[model samples]
Target: MFSCLKHKVGEVLLPGDEFSFQPEDTISLTDTVKPEKVICGPGLRRSGDRLLVSKSGVLRTKQPNMFWVDSQQKRYVPAKGETVIGIVTVKSGDVFKVDCGGSEQASLSYLAFEGATKRNRPNVQVGDLVFSQFVIANKDMEPELVCVDSSGRANGMGVFGGGGLLFRVSLGLIRRLLAPQSPLRAELQQLFPHELVIGMNGRLWVKASSVQQTLIIANLLESCENMTAEQRRQLFRRAAQGAL
Candidate 1:
């Protein structure tokens, strides 16, 4: 099978755009044609032999021919193995209910933490934020959270995001910030020194040098989510100059 991989990365694509498919539009007798196998990711659909974009955003592709539309969305869908920042709401007998901004509240076992037992319980209070991964997430079932990985290692996964600001943003922005080669991250770093925790569920935690700087950083980041590279660079440079 074959698929179209000719478009440049970070190309903005709107709804109804033909993202990738077998080039039935072009046929050459001398050229061999192969049946294409394209995985229609989010914001895309397959109609007959064609792939159609169903969301408004830039198109993104991974190696080995995986494609998806990166659209700005605030809703969170629980998915297994994805770490998220959640707020504790209820402390049950053993499990704590957390609101991870998903469709439903997730459950976190007190023993999910590393080196935690009934006698060695981790101190967690209501309204506190917990950075944990989804251990079980299915559409038909409530999601479950774990503070440690399958190997019983914390791997920097735990609670305690003291003295920081938490806010929400589009899911697309979070993905862009976490991207390995995103130019935005570099430009942002040049602006100031700050720490950021991005949750896949459209939530983020930020801590900067001071309150003013933190607010500036947060506003700047929110404004840059939908901008192009040149636009983001301009914004970041202006912020660095205290124009924010």
Candidate 2:
């Protein structure tokens, strides 16, 4: 049965829910008879042309047929190339062990920083917040972090907090914030002149002009994890008016 979707958009889906493809509705190309494509995102799996929901959450879709479940989760699973906010937990001879809310502590190399070398190493200490990207991550191996990009540039991937506030949000919201052309960013930008470090690991660092403003920003964002887009817009508008 490759022609039936169990749940519509915005419906909360449970694990084991199955969706099938509808050939007539999905295939409209007259030039060639191509089978309808179903792109299964996170929380979904494909087994023999059957779409299986693997998480309990609302199902969402984007333009051009991308589907994913919007699950509220706090735990983080390390993935390569995902930038995250990490706390330095241990400093080894050559690497720093960082707690990034994952199954295991991630490792950051001492030489990962820009302009760092044997003669001049970055002065990193335990308990400091580091905004790093995963360079090596796998299910079977320990995760490794780096502060620089492919060109050896730090690119805002280094020490994260300097007297700022660090907080946690659901991993799904973090992904929503990092999404390209996200409306949340636009709304937040209009609220305050602040700096935000969004980590894939559910940690966020925010800095505003003053302590009160910073707290307001932090609380506002944390509250957005469960709000709809319209709700967030209304809250942001009211908060901005109140702040100013």
Candidate 3:
């Protein structure tokens, strides 16, 4: 068995593997093994007697690779049933425009707001934070968000005022943190007393006691990927207790 030390072909060295190259000797893996046999890296070719490698990062064989990171700051991906927090951007008759951190804005109907059909539609003005879900995302990836409940009831959903902080963050960081089952959620419940979080792929809206506390929560969410599970729990606990 040949052991590849590194991903590069030239860096690969076997126990007793030996090959000779003359003044202008060009040797390629294809000469000895079939193209299918060659693996790791990309763009393998034979030029004269020398094997040339292309800079393109493609491997002939299927190999586990790292996930792709977006060049932009961390953002959130709209999941089918994901519960998201958003801010009202516009109100037009029965519908409102919301910024969900994507190229296309989201649409929220007045019926989705709490008490829309009741006595009178609560004034959900611009900059009001709302907790909603991804109801529909078209084939073009345009999302239509909603705040209505399963029975089409509007409760525990709508614009949040007071005791909340809003800010922007990379979408990548949001996915790293904020799990439904994570201790952070419970800890936050105790910290803010009454908190609402809206995570857009590019931004975040949080409501907490103080700006300092909100910043701590944001830092914890951003560092979730680097902290251990135990550490994360501890961090959440401390933040809840106002230690962080």
Q: What TM-score goes with each of the models?
A: 0.83, 0.85, 0.55
Best-first order by TM-score: 2, 1, 3
Tens digits of per-residue lDDT for model 1, 1-244: 2334345447777887764443466687997875556665788788876667788877777776777777778889998999899999999899999999998999999999999988999999999999999989999999999999889988878896877889998988898888898788888788779888888898889999998998988898888777888888887888888876
* Candidate 3 or 2, higher lDDT: 2
lDDT string for model 3 (23-64, tens) is: 324656565643223222323444444444433332233344
Which candidate achieves the best lDDT against the true structure? Answer: 2
* Runs off by more than 4 Å, candidate 2: 1-9, 20-37, 62-65
Query: What is the model-wide C-alpha lDDT for candidate 1?
Result: 0.84
Better of 1 and 3 by lDDT: 1
**Backbone clashes, each candidate:** 0, 4, 14
Off by over 4 Å in 1: 4-36, 45-56
Error of 2 at 121 (Å): 1.3
Order of candidates by lDDT, top first?
2, 1, 3
- Overall local distance difference test of candidate 3: 0.58
